[model samples]
Target: MKGQDYYIPAAAMAIALVFKLPALRNNWRDPLLRSVCVLLTLAGAVFTFAAPPTIDAVNEWTGIPNFSAPLVYCLMTAFSASCLVLMFNWRGGPAEEIRATSRRWISGYATVVVAIMVLFALGDAPEQRLRDFDTFYANTPYIRVMIAAYLLAHNVAAMTMVAMCWRWSLQVRGWLRGGLVIIVAGYAFSLTYDATKMSAVVARWLGHNLDDLSTYVAPPLASAGALISAVGFVLPLVCQRTSDSWQTWSTYRRLGTLWHEVQSTAPAGTPGVRMSWWSPAEIRVIQRESDIHDGFLRLGPCFDRRHRDAAYEEALAHGADEETARAVADAAMVAAAVRTSAADPEGTAAEDPGEGERVLIMADGPRDLVRISHALRHSPVVAATRRRATTADG
Candidate 1:
């Protein structure tokens, strides 16, 4: 392939690696994260070293004809091993079992890499064939063995990944399943790459020439497959994180209505705890909820069960569902309490619930808080009750 084709993918992988580095540094013991980083590193190296311009440069710089051949082959072998190790870690089983399996794959591929280098050193390739080295030396003793060895290793890894990901996809759902399916498709392309390269090599062994398949057809397939596989590996992680962030921010926004209403009634100089601008959405939400509950506590003496009961009956009479009616009633009570607390800042005139009346404002969690916020913003019963409380206070 051309320099741009190879370098572009290399650059992309480098960017992906950079994004993962912080997480990897913090959780270096995490095998899955390590596997991902290693896979990206090896994949990028394979593309960079296999480019025709890079191959020619390495040969010239090293003063050895076709020295780039074994270098690229060993890189490809390690890349294949990284893919298998990543899949094993990603599938997840007993921790020990995962570790053992990954180690075995790494050891085996390391052996393959050593063997490729040994074969290349023993074989004589006096003529440098930058792009067509595999097919050009397909019948030259140890060179032929090296070519078959790398292709076989690559094919085995591709087939194994396709099978594993396909089976695992069936057992999962959502984005994970989609990612696995895409990974399977990517490895399918990898298999096609192996097929084309092997076809050219085998044809050369049989006194025929199909060098075009190896020289022209296989590199693109390899590049496309690697790119697709990288996307598949990344899709589920990026999408899930995005989904979580969106939900947290939505919660923070929805709670704004209730927080604002209660905050206005808090004592002067006690404006609740203010969060820094750089806080995460989750931390911001926690702070808002804390402030809201503090407001509810300050307004507790102002709560009157009678106001809630009247609003609840009004909401039910107007065809609201039970859950919504409860929310409306609670919102009405809170709205009236805000005005009562304002009218009697000393809280001496505040009335408690009767013997059997239950206080629900502080009983539940964030879900109830969101419902009350919705009711405060939208319920007519809550609005009317607030108006009546204002009139009475005046």
Candidate 2:
């Protein structure tokens, strides 16, 4: 169970590291990102050391008797410290407060690490006890206290995170709230891990074997908790980025019909090579918006205010709201302009005073442009106005 349990956290740790690598590299100064990276690295190291197969390999290569034991214990202590620091950094309070909190956690955990090393140094385990190190060393003089100390530290960190998350969860919402809840659940399992292992150790001291609790029961709980905690940390960032990309892509696709219609009237406004299907949503949206503005600029002289006014009245008659009617009126003028520009590019001129030089609709942003595009594509008033202008010219 110990060896098999390692793989679950190992995979999760790898995924977390990969996901945060860009943030880690690009924004190394970001405290939250840095803390998360450190936490994940320590977690991976703990899992790597916990596995008997990995411990044996390192022991054989290093030729240090029971070296993996101290290494694993130290790594676990560091993992606990990193986890707490990550929580503090994640739940930002104030700059000075964060620094003070971080400094205190570091100083306290450093003392715990030193104590674990000293206890390992005092213990005499000539042979390796890979599978049942805690049970085998349960009665060994200073080693017993050392194991107890490490478990104490582990339990303290677990309880602290659980309490912190539970309290903080009440103040947050959406992904952060949900994440805190999952983290609390994971830490609940962590507390179970501590209780079960401590029970096994105490049982060994009492001249009985509850080794199965440590060997069979606690490892899976620890593994499950670690995996869930990692996911809880990463879920918000991953889900948000995914949602933003989906929205950008949706907006890009929805604007396509309107962009095509305007682009036909002003072919130069079409971004032929740059507007490929392979282009990123952000780039395509920018280019599409730019081209729509350019196409409207070219159609300015052809805009007829009377035609726009008629379209607005017709839109109101069709039960369109004020905003929708305005958008329909603008789209109708653009459609009529496209026909006028197509007929006589040189001869086309607006007869209305001071209206010929003004830009059509202005575009403004994606929302305004999208609304106009929607009216151009689907509004019956825009189509009717376009047909009336075409007939008048004929």
Writing each residue's lDDT as its tens digit, candidate 1 over 1-394 gives: 6899999999999999999899899999998889889988988898899888999999999999999999999998999999899889888899999989989999999999999999999998999998899988999999999999999999999999999999899999999999999999999899999999999999999999999999999999999999889888878877877898998899889999999999999768874566788889989988889888988888777888889999999999999999999999999999998998888888766653342243548537778899999999999999999999999877
What does the lDDT come to for candidate 1?
A: 0.90
By summed lDDT, which 10 consecutive residues of candidate 1 come out lowest? 351-360
TM-scores, in order shown? 0.90, 0.85
lDDT of 2 at 53: 91
Query: Global lDDT of each model?
Result: 0.90, 0.83
Q: What is the lDDT of residue 52 in candidate 2?
A: 85
**Candidate topping TM-score:** 1
Query: What local lDDT does model 1 show for residue 153?
Result: 96
Model 2's alpha-carbon lDDT is 0.83
CA displacement after TM-score superposition, residue 250 of candidate 1 (Å): 1.6
Off by over 4 Å in 1: 271-274, 309-322, 351-365
Mind giving the per-residue lDDT tens digits that candidate 2 earns over 209-310? 999898788888887787788778778767777888898888877778678877888655544645666777889888888777777777777777777888
